[model samples]
Target: MKRYLFLLVVGLLFFNFGNSQAYYFPERNSNWATKVEASNSFNQIALEEAVRFAKDNEYSGSRDLRIAILKGFEREPFHKILGPTKKRGGPAGMILKNGYLVTSWGDTKRVDMTFSVTKSFLSTMAGLAEDQGLIKDIDDRVGDYIWDGTFDGEHNSKITWEHLLQQNSAWSGELWGGKDWADRPPREGGVHDWKFERPKEPGTVMEYNDVRVNVLAYSLTHVWRKPMPIVLKEHIMDKIGASTTWRWHGYNHAWTEIDGIKMKSVTGGGHSGAGLFISAEDMARFGMLFLNDGKWKEDQLISKEWIQKAIKPSKPNVNYGYMWWLNKKGNRHWEGLSENIYYAAGFGGNFIVIDQENDLVVVTRWLEPNKIAEFMGLVNDAID
Candidate 1:
């Protein structure tokens, strides 16, 4: 009887100790402290190799980013992109272990355009809308909320918030000078092939179209009844204690009237220039929130169910989520990376990789696409 009682006490103690060692927020203003006090079959050498890889393999994409974006979209040259972009950029990133900054490189502090990584943040805003009941049901017809002719046609009328989130809505027409078909035309097709292609049933096929993502942005603006940046700042960024240096932007022509006031409808990506411009450290903090299943410290910034929903593969594209890229079966999938590993990816190889299995988060900028798997594999090998 005494032994049984002692065993019960021991089990309780172990449970409490295990719970105490869970995740925590990193210090806001300080450089991350290295916990690699000892070296060996541990991550010290792996960290060194990873740093070297980032420094050597800079993005091999187009040197002139603005031109690349414009040509990709087949759009006219505009005076300026909607968001701020630096004339220069270099390899930058941060490694987080159990919600603490483990290491970082380059100008992680410099605010640079994160491009399509903005989509993940936009996805977060949509998750927020769902959490606050601003959007009743993602599966329901968004036409109920947005009465504009945007989703009015027979094929389009069937679109739901889910379809838009998945980029399968094939939402017709134009927004802010960008056309649905022209945003990112397939390399295999001519202009006529793209323009004349009939819209597929929602959720039947997936296409990566920035204009449709922008439609989600515009619709979300209506649902929240505020500029997306304002909503993002108030609810997500500030709540997580993000630095004041970050900026979110929308196109100059995207502004229009809503409820007797004008608001700018933001883009889902920086293809035309304007999305989330932020420091790597802040990006890590944001990734940590998702790593902790959408919790910030003690406040539940977003629900676990929503995180599950966001990370789960969309029917049309197993590699894509609400906006996050899954390291599963898509072209970007890495054979060595865990299936559960997912990321917020942008142009020029910018990535915020979440490895929940390892309790690690890695944010990188200007990382070449071809070398991603190689880099990720090296990091995995570091795990002792």
Candidate 2:
């Protein structure tokens, strides 16, 4: 009886430990546990079909073409973290160049929180605003755009619009991370008391910062005389003929799951990231817009010159553009793009790669952390 009780106790302890080891975030849902059993969920199958369609049209694979595709997906640390959740509620729909349905990969369900990818969307809208003379050039100062005293700090007031776009605003990024200013709500605090760490002179360096983009978001509203979401819907989404079923989760950053499990928005960008939920097909259309110089079916959504200037390499650094990443060698032999393929990437494997020179736009959405290198190798080999 003693031995039997001991074994029973051990089993119970093991079960308890196992339960303790269960990995879960505060916002994980049962839907995430529900995997997509169909092979049609992944965009790869669709991409293969798209490739075959292009091949039928006498378009042979070139090293340059593949390189552009691979470079777009590869070189990002965030893309690797999207594979495991592939079966979970992720990206819906797929669109490709070369004119084909690609493969079936679920419906055009507007259920995806494309993180920083929204930044690219916002950036494009800002560019359009500039073209329409609503705002001035990228070189305009923040004060010039949002005169409501948002940028009225000693150092921050001097920050320019280009500085925010370039990620070189020199403002302390920690301020927005809910660090010392947790009690202070963002964008509502006193501008005079805002403390910023000026590492280097603005416009001379590049540092990825979300607060700067939030500032950009605020600036867009100030200039457009409309809410940011309304601005986007009116200017970009409607202009691009995107589905109106989408909703921007402005606050609370909760995921709209089938069940009651409210998932908090991870990655980055509230509206910049968690706000804009879109279908992969619409994302592909967005990519194609950039691919075709911001023109959709001969209707110019944005000016051709604006598109050219946005993707073109920035001065002093060829690795980044306006709200986009460029394929440029950093230090090692990492040759990403032969001609700097511009890509708009989002967290959780959301990618809309536009290789203009190669006439390619590849879109992918998955959930696997730490599988980026493996997928990147596949991408490189396939592209090569």
Candidate 3:
């Protein structure tokens, strides 16, 4: 009886292992397969509830994104839209389970501006650089690559690739007509106070400053010796079978010469303007790549090691990891969800959530920011 029971247990283990290896990946320009009627893995009513919640709780910001950009960041001094802004569409998103489309709302093909979610893409560029040996190590000083005065000062010189990736660089500088002190100054402080304040040690405090992020972008442009968008397309997007509609934009004045050719340095976020403009479906594809440990079909577009490092929490911010937001127990934690969940989030409710534990990828656009946790929780509750 004991031998028979052990044989049954081994058989079950092999079956589960074989099933886990059967994740589907969509091809370029191909329709993503749906499991709505075919699969009984999800609670259909609960899944519908998640979709309804996302659609009903659309972002309150103006659809005319130019007006939204200016008004949303009105507190910043001299804030101007220096890059292209497009009017966004209604609430649009998709939920994928085991790489199959489970449910989606709005026009999934409509290309919309994804604000700071661009940071995660920028972070991926750094990972690619490291994977290709362009960046020897994340701990290496940024000043070593670009000797331009950007990282000259004592405080800025101490900044490393990891520090910038973690948003704890605290590098003080102005770029593309945006001042470091003026980007998003504290509510209680004036320009004089912010400008004169000493910067914290690199890798110490996490501050969400766009100027610093742009600096990282500028430095990476030098490291890769090409426009970031081109690198992204050739290295990641193309490999993942992303659509042609996606674009990565930089500020009008962020152009610089590299290898005797001028290339625009893209912003990590859409603070003043311009970042990644992509369709919900493309974003889902990118999330799917990350969900599969940076692999798409037979290709490992990005190293598994890089993806692991990208999602691991930094010491300075447990909820942040190389521009990706963690669902860890912090201020941004989504209650009742898996702690292993991580996502790319942008302003005005753009999100690409990767729930690896459940083999789920959720892309949400124009959702009310505060309602994300609840919406995600509802989606989580749908799994059988």
lDDT of 3 by residue, 1-384 (tens): 999999999888556433644567899999989754324668989989999999999999899999988999999888899998899999999988778888889999999999999999999999999999999998999999989899998888898999999999988878898888888889997878988999899999888989889999999999999999999999999888899999999999889998799999998989788899999999999998988888888788899999999889999899999999999999888888999999999999999999878888999999999999999999888887
Candidate number with the higher lDDT (2 or 3): 3
**TM-score, one value per model:** 0.90, 0.63, 0.95
Q: Worst ten-residue run, lDDT, model 1?
A: 33-42
lDDT of each residue in 250-288, candidate 1, tens digit only: 887788678999998888888778888888888888988
Cα lDDT tens digits for candidate 2, 1-384: 999999999888556423422211111111211112112323564446443432233212122322322343343322222111112243333433332333335444545556577778777767888899886677778776665556676766778766777666664333223221221223544533444322466777665655556656656655665555676677667766666665554433322222343332222243222346666666766776777676665467799888777766666467677888776664211244445466676545566766554444566655231332333333333431
Backbone clash pairs for candidate 3 read none
Candidate-wise lDDT, in order: 0.81, 0.52, 0.90
Best prediction by TM-score: 3
The better-scoring model by lDDT among 1 and 2 is 1
**For model 1, what is the alpha-carbon lDDT of residue 131?**
89
Query: Cα lDDT for residue 283, model 3?
Result: 97
